[model samples]
Target: MINIPFNKPYLTGKELFYIEDAVKKGKISGNGYYTQLCQKYFESKYGFNKCLLTTSCTDALEMAAILIDIKEGDEVIMPSYTFVSTANAFVLRGAKIVFADSRLDHPGIDEDQLESLITSKTKAIVPVHYAGVACDMDKIMNLANQYGLYVIEDAAQAIDSFYTGKDGIKKALGSIGHLAAFSFHETKNIISGEGGMLAINDRKFAERAEIIWEKGTNRSAFFRGEVDKYGWVDIGSSFLPSEIIAAFLWAQLENLEDIQQVRIAHWENYHQKLQEWTSDNLIQLPVIPSYATNNGHMFYLICKNLKQRTTIIDNLKSEGILSVFHYISLHRSQFYKGKNFNTVLKQTDIFSDCLLRLPMYYELKVEDVIYKITEK
Candidate 1:
């Protein structure tokens, strides 16, 4: 039986050459030559004010939490239909997480409901670009400005995605947020085994970001000779990734356009083939808003309910294909149970029960997609 995985890291041939070069240079630690190259690529390509590669997206989110200065009892609003790290990062900073519902058409947070949740204690809004689909940033950003709230975008799946605002200006997902996090995990469009980056869009947070990423020390200042000696300056952590991983990441970044095209083809093929199921009322294909550009990070189908989702998932697994579900609505998770301050998450519950992610990766072939769909 030849089984297809839900995802597999696609490698560009340049990885070994870069890794060997890094090894020959004898600098494998964080922020070395290859690391700098990767950072510069993102900065130039994405128009990010500053880009710092982290050990993982989880680490980058934590770094954003620290940079935002989320404090105890401060309320942070975010959609519950997100990876736990999105909420856990702020929660770790002693902030109270207020769950929000997803929009009916898209799984991102409902911007209309966001304003009503704002209060004097509200500190920030984290919007997860679910499956690389852009959230309604125009509404979210306007609300953030109105309420004086910080916006941290969880763009784990939105590396190549774009949004055209109401004013006719096009912006990349990570660039629009005050601060954003990206993942290059094996399961993502790009791969570094386990890696991520923090995109600092706000100038005010740039300098402090380097120090915070380097374990709350002025080590970055010392390296640049801005200071005579480096020592602990504030609260921080070792969030930076190694140069070896950066070397691997550089290979992917070099061929990003080619990789994106391949994945986009696969995504569109799935959508085109499965669109008829919508009429049958068997499942709903992914809904991409008009303002968003496809990045080919994921392709999912919405089953009628949890029961149908479970049945489909099991059926796929039995057929030697792996399918999966997403976040379980953190507000209702075991860890958050009994927390009185949590808000109702109607859409989050619906998303959790209905959404099912299909196999999607840079190397997924058209035949494999056809096979999976035909099994239905």
Candidate 2:
């Protein structure tokens, strides 16, 4: 039996070199040379007004919630078929979560039904770009504008993905919304062991975002001599990542193009190989909209039902090939059961039951994954 793990972190060969250089700089703390390099790389590459590296995407989202001033009784609308962090960030700030359903074609939030979910209390809309595929940003952004709501894009899996609006201008995923969050987890396309970033596109939040990232202090401004001294200024936590993680991330950024090409090839291979299964209605493949570009973050199949998915997982385990299911619907979660959500998210529940993520990583051979997945 050939053993294949679900994910393996990739190293770009320069991680250690950059980390050693960071150590030699005599500053391994949060906002050091390497940290600035990683932040600048994203701001320049994605055209974001500002970027700040965080310890995790959760922290980034929390910072977004803070920047937007989510308050008690405020309602935040987002898909139920997302990681808990998406909702938790706002919930922690005392906002009420309005659970939205997933699209029938994809696991992203159902854009068509968003208007019906909004109320006077709706303060923001968080669109999660599942599987690195861009959500319908034009529609989502239009809704936000009409309703006077902030848009915080949950771009954890969408570092390099893009969306082309009706104006025919292509915008990076994180650059479209008022704010966005990204992840560089070990399982992500870009690995830094554990890291994330906050992209602030709306200039209004620029200064405050930096202060929030630096533990609610004006330290960042103080460092640039904009202030005489740094002190506790606002409500915040230690959100910035240390220089070592940023050093590792910079090495990955240096090789991003090469890495993206390989991942795209692997993603295409899976789509082609699984066509027959998908055509037979045995499972459903990922869907990419015309306005959106794929970032090759993940390739997943939707099983017909929970039992079939379970059988498939068991078969893969028997073959020594590891496959896994994704998130559960937050609306139906144990934590949400006692809460006051009246929404019936059928599509979200279906995805929670059926979606399965196959083994995907930078180093894994496409042919090996195809063979294991298609084996009778």
Candidate 3:
């Protein structure tokens, strides 16, 4: 029997070639030729003002925190149903996390419930594009405008996604927010083992972003010959990733279109075959609002409750298929058990219990997906 993995990194066969090129070129450190090539590819392809590859998505979020100056007592509004890195980055800066609920139909922050949470203490809003689906960016931007708060998109799953506004203006997910973070983790649609990038959309933060990425020094400027000598100027960390990882990522980026097509085909197969379950009220499928474009990052099914979800998970495991649940809401975690919040997150609780992600990867065949759902 063959075991189906929940996620797997798909190599495009250029990894070794690029890695060998990096080694032969004698620059395996961060920001080498391959790294610059990957950065330029993202900047040109996505229209991002600047992109810096980091060690991980966690590191990218931490960089965004520094760029935004998240400080003590500042409040960062975000959904509770997200990876801890989404909240941990700000929390580490002594900022208070104001967790919001998810929307009923989507695993994104409820825009309607966002306004009342804003106060003078609110410094930013971190919107996670769960499952590569775009959030309500227009409403989020409008709210940010009204409150004078920064918007940092936790777009870990949202590379290559787009949002078409009601006014018919189309914008890429990471390009709209003041700052955004993307992951190229092996579990994602793209893979670089454990790599991520920070997308700086706001022009004002471009130069400072480079400094922040380079251990808070003016070294980048010095290396560019803008300064005769460089030294530490502000607080920063070693957020940059190695050239080897960047080389691997560049290969993935070069084959982005082809990989995306394969994953999208697999995603559609899951949806089409599972339509019967939805029609019979046995399970709920992932919902893509009309305004957003799918990026094929995740495919999930919502069971009636936690028990049913557990049953399905065990059943799938028995059949040698790996499926999983995600995101125990941070608000309910034992660490924050006694903390207070503005409002109850009803939808987040529902999603935390009911949602189950099926196996999705570039290599997953349509027949394999059909077999998983249609068998028993």
> Model 1 scores what on Cα lDDT?
0.90
The lDDT of each candidate is 0.90, 0.92, 0.90
Each model's total of backbone clashes: 0, 0, 0
Say which prediction, candidate 1 or candidate 2, comes out ahead on TM-score. Answer: 2
Q: Write the per-residue lDDT of candidate 1 for residues 1-376, one digit (tens) a residue.
A: 3387888889889999999999999999998999999899899988999999999999999999999899899999999898888988998999988888999888889989999999999999999999899999999999999989999999999998999999999999999989999999988988899999999999999989999999999898898899999999888899999899999999999999999999999999988877776548678888889999899998888888899889888887887788899778888898888776455788788888899988888767757756666657
TM-score of each model, paired residue for residue: 0.97, 0.98, 0.97
lDDT tens per residue, model 2, 98-209: 9899999999999999999999999999999999888899999999999999999999999899999999999999999999999999999998988899999999999999
- Model 3 global lDDT (CA atoms, 0 to 1): 0.90
Error (Å) of candidate 2 at residue 277 is 2.9
Candidate number of the best lDDT: 2
Candidate 3 wrongly placed segments (more than 4 Å): 338-343
Residue 17's lDDT in candidate 3: 96
Cα error, residue 219 of model 3, in Å, equals 1.1
Lowest-scoring 10 consecutive residues by lDDT in candidate 3?
335-344
On residues 1-376, what C-alpha lDDT tens digit does candidate 3 reach at each position? 4388888779999999999999999989998898899899989988899999999999999999988998899999999999999998998999999999999999899988899889889999999999999999999999999889999999999989999987899888899889999998899888899999999999999899898899999888998899999999988889999899999998898899998988888888889888986667578999999999998899998888999899888888888788899999898887666665544688999999999999998777657656766666
